[model samples]
Target: MARNIVISGASSGLGRALAIEFAGPGATLGLLGRNSERLDETAARAREKGAVVRSAAVDVRDRDAMRSFLLDFDAAAPIDCIIASAGVTMVTPVPGEVEDLTRAEELFDVNLNGAMNTIAPIAPLMRRRRAGQIVLFGSLAAFAPPPDSPSYAASKAALVAFALATRALYRADGVSVSVVCPGFVDTPMAGSYSSWKPLMMSPEDAARRIRRGLDRRKAIIAFPLPLYLAARCQQWLPDSLRTAAMLRFRAVQRLPVR
Candidate 1:
């Protein structure tokens, strides 16, 4: 059967890929993004696939705007799936330099709080319907705090925790909640990193994995078996060893070019 799907950050990256994946003759898509041009491009592509597309160029950080858009979309079509895929990475601080507190807050507002803005308004509606999927985009960095990207790690970690908790709470309600923890995905967001990105997957492939996981109603959808296993093993390592190993990792320390 056709599904009513909503995707935030659908202008690019995994969000765009997922939209394309779900688009078809019977599908209805409501996509949101900050870039009007890109968002239009995505909508056009989905329309070409015979999917009914409605798109809005709006920042996820605008809670009222996000809430209104989502609520209206749900009222119109009754959402079957909602993916909170919008997020921003914080700039890695240089050695011996402290991260700017303001920048950290900005990153959190978009990455963590923005996710809440996207999911919170729709969660109850999904519960009432008793048949919908809520997918949250986290990261492998959620497994360990990267000294270089503290804010990003913290935001993703919070998502991981929140997704798990939501899954447990909503299981009986027939509302499936899932967290996707991808490693390095080859997106503009990942392009900002200056360090080696191991096992980086294309966004299409990542989206495929995510879709499969959601179809199976997985609670945690972490990807690339090798990388995921490595991250899991890090939890068992001694703190001193893990910290020393992580300290050797290097990435760009300057503010990201938005």
Candidate 2:
């Protein structure tokens, strides 16, 4: 098991669940999130499990801040694993409507650039050490881009590509990189989407599955096998058919309070 773990977006959702799942005696956790109160809450829970916890309220989009935090934490205790779980999504409320440009920018900043910021600061360190694990959180939507949340799907798709490339690049250095593409997880993030969510999973269950995949050093950790398959199959359909199929799922994004 990885003894020193770093997780971003640890305030809530799958990130929080992953922090708790990995917490235990002899473990050292470095958690980063935008919300201080919720980040502290996650820290408290990990401490209860006898793990040493250090948390920071830092936005993943801030490259300098993320670099400093990651380096400082790594200096204290070499990081064994890093989970880049910060992300955001938004959808047009109705058919034929487009997402706001400002909102789409924010989504990309958080979902794509934010992930790169998380990995950039520490990847070299891990590579030099010749031992580490890096995990990126994508989404099943990457395989089947949603008409309502085009930017969200695009961002996740970019992450999937990034993960694969990085994995291949770092394989020779003994640094394992994995990407997680999960279907609708029963998180606050998911709650914002008013749409049919088949095979939705709880955060705890999602965390467990992620951990299992990490243990095996799998390149892609996608869960709810049926949904994953369906998403992949959707990619094979003709463009018109794919778009028609996607249009059937009505999703309204009700912005959640961070």
Candidate 3:
């Protein structure tokens, strides 16, 4: 029997790539994205790979809409895996280049709150089934304070701790949780990066790594070894020193917008 998998943010970048990678013989994919065009593209690609592709064009922040879709999915087929990849981020400076209170709220709504909405709907089903896997997208930016992308950084960082708690709560229920932290990916999301982005992997490579880690049921899957190591170094430093270092890191991206 083909296993049922749900992917949020399936319109592009890592989520799109992941949908393609997982689509193949014996896979039933329920792809969700906000954009209809891009979602169609992803579904087409998945279908080409012999997977059963279905889509729901709904914002991740809409709790009721998400629940409606998820319940429909559960009724049609049992979901075996769920990847909550729907998130938004930007390097655009707040209160300046892209200063809008509404944008800031939207960012949080999608990145953090949206994640909860994405995961919560499917979690009950997984818990009831007593078998499932959840793969959350964390980031190297999640490791440090990102003054330039305050909300984005905070969301990812918060997820790290959230995953920790989730692991404890869900492990005994036969549901495994894995949080993937990729330093930099050459995706549309990070294309605007102006500063150094080391050991960046293509979307394909990142997707492959994500599947491998999930298959192995790893608790934390951080990649591009060197960069992951670099991020981890902050843990060894004293809090005062680490805070100072983080401030410097954000300072480098402080050049005035042209």
On TM-score, the candidate that comes out on top is: 2
- Candidate 1: segments with Cα more than 4 A from true spot: 253-255
Better of 1 and 3 by lDDT: 1
Clashes of each: 0, 0, 0
User: Per-residue lDDT for 1-258 in model 3, tens only?
Assistant: 227999998998999999999999889999999889989999999999999987989998899999899888878978888888988775655433533567767777888788888889888789888988887888888876555677678779888888878988999898888888887788767765455566878999999998888888988899987878868898689988877766554422334321
All candidates: CA RMSD (Å): 1.5, 1.1, 3.4
Q: What is the overall TM-score of model 1 with all chains considered together?
A: 0.96
Give the C-alpha lDDT of model 2. 0.92
Local distance difference test values of all predictions, in order: 0.87, 0.92, 0.81
> Considering TM-score, which of the candidate structures 2 and 3 is the better prediction for this target?
2
Which candidate ranks first by lDDT, i.e. highest?
2
TM-score of each: 0.96, 0.97, 0.89
Candidate 1: give the clashing pairs.
none
**Which clashing pairs does model 2 show?**
none
Could you tell me the lDDT of residue 256 within candidate 2?
A: 62
List candidate 2 stretches off by more than 4 Å: none
